[model samples]
Target: MHRTPTRRQIQAKLSTMPPQRSQATAYLNAYKMMLEKERLEEELDKLEVRRHQIQQRLAILNSQTIPEGDMTHQQANTNLEDNTPKFKTLTLEY
Candidate 1:
């Protein structure tokens, strides 16, 4: 004759099952990594927005036209001279 397991016996058997230690550890690590990735992505997005704003400001400044009465020919010539590049030539004879 066989007897059915009582409530206490069933509870004891369930308690004896192995804990999912490795699986739990892996899940926690993955969750931390995901959070770090999200934070970095948000930081990158903020930097991109700042870059766009700076570029727009630069474009506006570059496109502004100087009034003819305000700029003198001598000043323009000075500006050109300052911006002109000086080149040196190196000749190699082998």
Candidate 2:
């Protein structure tokens, strides 16, 4: 199976490379850096989306009105806990 290379492995390989062909090495390193940048940008996008979604949920929750009555704290807590929505989150791994 093909596995992704770790930053440490890439750095070690680059360090031990023969320094004469610097141009080729630079191009290859640039490509790897670009890939890493793209991956981070994608993660940032996912985080932005998740943030927006959470904000929307919070707005909805804040706008909700509760009936006024002599209710106990336990009942209100239960209602809040039961009605709150659970969301799936992004899992990032190298």
Candidate 3:
């Protein structure tokens, strides 16, 4: 005949186990690593958002004025001649 251990007996047995201590330590280390990774990712996201905001601000500051009516300056002009070499000529010569 075999007897089943009670809940208190099982708890007492678990308290003396070395493997349980090691398992707890491993779980703690894994949790710490996960937290550190999450913190770093959050920092990276903040930096990326700041960078995007700076880029938008810079674009607004560096905005150019567009001229109205019959002026080629507002549009890019490319030579359609196949034999002509590409040059860095401005659409409107100031």
Candidate 4:
């Protein structure tokens, strides 16, 4: 029984071909471009994953409260101080 050649076998045959043939040059160029495209796609996938992680981290930070340790003593004291109005009320006669 005869079996069809695999993709790797076809690629091997193309690689060993002399550069003098225009058809071989085209095939080689195509092969190189395909490899480069695959590499770029993989890099894009990595960057997408990193972007998602950063977004998740941002969401988590937004949902949580700021710890006291992250604030200066003055800031902590200011927040703890009373925020009630201290201005005297002026009565205006109509």
Q: Which stretches of candidate 1 lie over 4 Å from their true place?
A: 1-21, 65-94
lDDT of 3 by residue, 1-94 (tens): 8798665521211224354457878896677679777887999999999999999987776563223332454343433335576677668766
- Provide the clashing-pair count of each candidate structure: 0, 0, 0, 0
In order, what is each prediction's RMSD in angstroms?
Answer: 22.9, 19.0, 19.6, 14.4
Tens-digit per-residue lDDT, 3-83, candidate 4: 987665223224565567589778978888898778879999999999999999998886663554456666868867967
> lDDT at 77 for candidate 4?
81
Candidates, ranked, TM-score: 4, 2, 1, 3
RMSD of 4: 14.4
The segments of candidate 4 whose C-alpha lies over 4 angstroms from its true place after superposition are: 1-21, 66-94
lDDT of all the models against the reference? 0.72, 0.74, 0.64, 0.75
Clash pairs, model 4 backbone = none
Candidate closer to the true structure by lDDT (higher is better), 1 or 3? 1
Q: State every prediction's TM-score relative to the real structure.
A: 0.48, 0.49, 0.45, 0.50
Those runs of model 2 whose alpha carbons end farther than 4 Å from true positions after fitting are 1-21, 65-94
**Lowest summed lDDT window (length 10), candidate 3:** 9-18
Scored by TM-score, the top model is 4
Once all C-alphas are superposed, what RMSD does model 2 give against the true structure?
19.0
